[model samples]
Target: MTGLLRAEWTKFRTVRGWVLGMVLAALIIVLLGVFTAANNYSSCEGPDGDDCPAVPLGPDGSAVNDRFSFAHQVLDGDGEVTVRVASLTGTITYPPPDHDKIVPGVVPWAKAGIMIKESVRQGSAYAAMMVTGGHGTRLQHNFDGDAAGSPGASWLRLTRAGDTITGAESADGVRWTTVGTVRLAGLPPIVRVGLFAASPCDLTVTQGDLGGTIGKCRLARAVAAFDHVSLAGNPWTHDDVGAMRGAPALSQGAFRESGDTFTVSGSGDIGPYGLEGGQPVERTLSGAYTGLIVVIVVAVMFITAEYRRGMIRTTLLASPRRGRVLVAKALVLGAVTFVTALIAALVAVPLCRRILRGNGNYLLPVSTATELRVVLGTAALLAVAAVLALAVGALFRRSAAAVITAITVIVLPHVLATASVLPVELSQWLLRLTPAAGFAIQQSVPEYPQVTGHYVPQMGYYPLPPWGGFGVLCGYAALALGLAVVQLRRRDA
Candidate 1:
């Protein structure tokens, strides 16, 4: 280890090209991270509030006791009672018994997930997913593969693994894979599970507008002796882990539904589109974080190019220990990228928090945990990328061609999908196979409607969960590293 460390250190120090690449990687990462984070939070993030004009008053000047229909309910004749969003405003004739104390309304605590079963024997909406809007209502995405207003087809489906529940899907089902493990949540838990989805599409969306209400979304059949259910994972967290902190609160806050004619105070939370002054729908910023990945590939090319120049051989000759040389390079790359990514995260997170503070209801209350997640996660991601680059570079001595090939393979197909050249059927399959699919981690959103054999298929927020996305990326990194090691052992310098 010591010899390897020395060799790596010497090799890295002597190579001005490597140093330049490191610096470049850091600069690009910082700029992109800060720019993207600030923009999203400033415009759309918010907390649910307790202001209602929808509740109707009674004939004797009393508040009506309406049964809770959706997620959030406004206080009427007083005591804590649930009501639909559309009913928030009206005449408060018969005020509730505890009306004074009910200053405003907020949603109660709840979580949503996808449940997989051996079979949807009853055919009761084969897969049921729970979704929450900006207003904090519980809704379900059942049997609808494509969400309303979405561009794609019925991109959702279920698959089975013998008697076990395995959610699966395909851009085209010919090549399907397991999304995640699913089952019930607690002791004597129900056989089926909850599904969740979110729509950033509504026009009236606001910080307070990005919630939903789920009246009663569930699965029909019992999941008997299931496996891999809880492990399905959340995908959106891959590219933007920080988004989780600003996610719509399931427990508190008033989620509003926005509109062109001001906002419908009584209506449920507006979707992401309804949020006031949010990123334009067309400019959703889908590619920013992915750019960082490209930069990593570029750096790898710079290093790998050295091998083609026979520079690596010279490097090894100078150092005398092949392993030491590799270790040194890895350390330098990891250290530099970690610091760079960390600084970017620190600057970007607070800037976003500050910008989002403009919204009165949705304050950016970041905790220590959120901060750690941002910094640590960024470093880890970059480190993995760097290691992969090292492996790739070492395996093929030519830098330019390898870099180009890597980038083309990793990023090109996703680009084609965007252009509509690739069908949804093919695209869904590609989503799992590509490195870009790993970006699902950055999502603050959770996917819903757990099904068998889908990519974290439980809901829209998934299709790929955070940790799972990371694991996928890690797997690629390990594979690339393993291949490089094999070549190193077999070939003569």
Candidate 2:
């Protein structure tokens, strides 16, 4: 087994053309991923009142939406804060297409309520208890923890004990129901605790009968009135002394406090935006994933090239066990491609962000762990696809035939599903059942029911869980490898 594996690896590395093809695959991943992200710049609005015009976002920008607004006060040390939210309301404003400018519609994941943040800075560590315009009550902490559908309690509280914060909700502020708990490590002695509002304006455009989501968007404002105001910390002095009393920014929007009543309103995003950069940052390989075409090519050639050059006979003679020989080849291909693709994915993610920032645009918020998964998982994704391609190539044993079949069977389905070329349902099934399911590995933002967006593949949303999708891809590769082994034993070398 070891000898057979060594022989296959030697043959693969010794051929300069094959080595160059592998290098080309990595270069393609980086160049395509980074340059595509660099060219796309996304600017979001908070208090500025700016928004994305109803224009097409080309290929890279359509699936991204990350904007929100927040208003908070800094409090020193650990203490409890509770507030009764009288109402949570929002309105979606269409920009002049229809005569009716403001529509009574709440975007999915429109959140308004109380929160405790390590800082007011975007992407800082925080925990929130919010009432969605539609999805009921939720207790979300940081970028990943979400405890949604907690009985629609209007009065929310965040009690901190050292690094741990417990989120509780109540109907009357008397009976508190524990919703969730989270630990914010290195929480500064002083932290921001107050009200916030945000909405992800998913722009759904209806062209005649077909309603296709053109942009993951936001063009709305969420307003909430909080009374029964209570605090256990120092009174947060809001600065803006010379800005006048009736500033529209303060009167109609932002935060206004009078006695025990506080009205908070904002427009922008709060939660961590889904995987990839919200609007500005394109992470999931964007054009770089097209480089998988090169990866597939190299993968198919891994075996077909041997068959084309009549080297199969020598390979079989060197390793008499046909099944063992196939396994060795698969192992070699999977390992090498895994390393190459991993390097490409890691390089592409950070580089893409740098380029996007260079253009004065910022990526949506995502956790450090999620970032790691995207980079590492993309590599795993490519490795799995490459192995699957190799197995399919072995089954066909013809370079052209294998390459064409692999593309038709694997690559096309992903492109059609991910690019919105097919119906969302059909695309989801294709991803669920096909090797292209491997792409789920790179998804950093998980689909939350509370958050509304196109959870379909075209918008980079995967129906299957990341590991689950990857598992399905692996299953197909395993099945293909099994069939290839059987064929190698029966068919002439």
Candidate 3:
């Protein structure tokens, strides 16, 4: 295997043209990363208040997402509650382009349903079966798991049987599917259990708005109309946790009753804060993915060129085990791309910080550790993409076709997702399923339920966690490599 690898390396390095292609990939990443970071500028000013709207930054200085809306009534003892959500619609009031009026836009992840909370303190353990604006039905619990379910389920039922609380969603009200169960330990008899709605979006600051020079991250609110709500065993009572109407943090949220049904409109934040102001969306390493195009093109050409120039026979002759030849080539391609991309990203990220701060643009808070992750993740993403393209090139053995396939399959999805070319649902799926998921590795800021802006693709926030998203791309590479090896073993080079 070592001999086979050495032979592949010798063939690759001896070619000056291919060497230059690798050089170009590195230069592209560095150049674009720097240029985009420098050019993308922003600024922010006020939101005058004591608990003034702040970018949720942790001890590490990266964004600490916190925001959501909760409308509920306190239940003093353990019991079960069941409700049918007729429909869930989410709303965000954006600062108008002219700053004269409030513009309303539908929010993604806008949720309406029944919840049982340990407290209204935001971060307390909770569970719910909900119907979202764009994500369909979900059985979300805790802080991170936004668990998915079959579409169009209308009934949300939560029952506290002893210490374990179980949530279920039913298509017909009679037949139910268990979303999950959670034991909110230290079992308090009383809990805040009722309807809730939340949305996170950016309140756009106009060109000369006084309240904000750039943005004041505003929380989103979801609304649900229920045909019926029954707390099977007890009487429900209103509990504000002591915040008066129009409180600074609560922001004018209220609940009302209309006949047997109830309507709740509340504003506050729950979960991670999606807050950043005056910070340019294009932070360091913006537009870095454009360089992956060149990396993939070069990587595809690496193998396709071998076949085109009739060098595959010579490659196989040196290593009679044809599968070994493919593995060696993939390792060589992935390693070279990783090094080149790493150097490029390291140089570009620092330059971006310098230029952005020089322009007086406030960047989203980032820790030193987060910075390292972003830089390394970019290189890893590029390395994986290069390997994917190389594998595809092996399968097809056609330079033009493989290059086209690589760009179309891997590159275009990222572009469409970033641009938010389609509906949010479709855009998210594109990133989740495609090789473009690799871009999540470079997501510097996280999506906070407390803040909403243009939650589209180009903002650099992703629906998947960094490594989780990158894993999708890696999966593609692994599958393609496996297939390419099989083909190499069976077919003539």
- For residues 352-419, write the lDDT of model 1, one tens digit per residue: 44444433223312235544653566567666666766677777766665676566655564464344
Question: In candidate 3, where is summed lDDT lowest over 10 consecutive residues?
Answer: 206-215
Q: Give each model's clash number.
A: 112, 8, 20
Clashing residue pairs in candidate 2 are 67-268, 67-269, 68-268, 68-269, 69-268, 201-217, 201-218, 275-445
Candidate 3, residues 1-493: lDDT per residue as tens digits?
A: 8887787788778888878887887777677767776776554434442333345443233443334445566777777778888766544554446333344444556666788877765356677777776676776665544667667888888888656788788888899898777766665677788887655443554322322123365545556677668854445554443233344432444566677777655444334433244453335665566778888888888898878889888878877988888888889888888888888777776777788778656667656666678788888888989989999999999988899999998989888766634555667888899998888887766665423454546455677998899999999999999999999888877
What is the clash count of model 3? 20
Q: Against the true structure, what is each candidate's TM-score?
A: 0.48, 0.77, 0.61
TM-score of 3: 0.61
Each prediction's RMSD over C-alphas, in Å, is: 17.8, 6.0, 8.7
TM-score of decoy 2: 0.77
- Residue 87 lDDT, candidate 2, scale 0-100: 81
lDDT of 2 by residue, 84-128 (tens): 889877777665454256766666677878878776544567788
- Model 1: lDDT of residue 320: 62
The global Cα lDDT (0 to 1) of model 1 is 0.39
Alpha-carbon runs more than 4 Å astray in model 1: 33-298, 318-324, 355-371, 413-428, 448-462
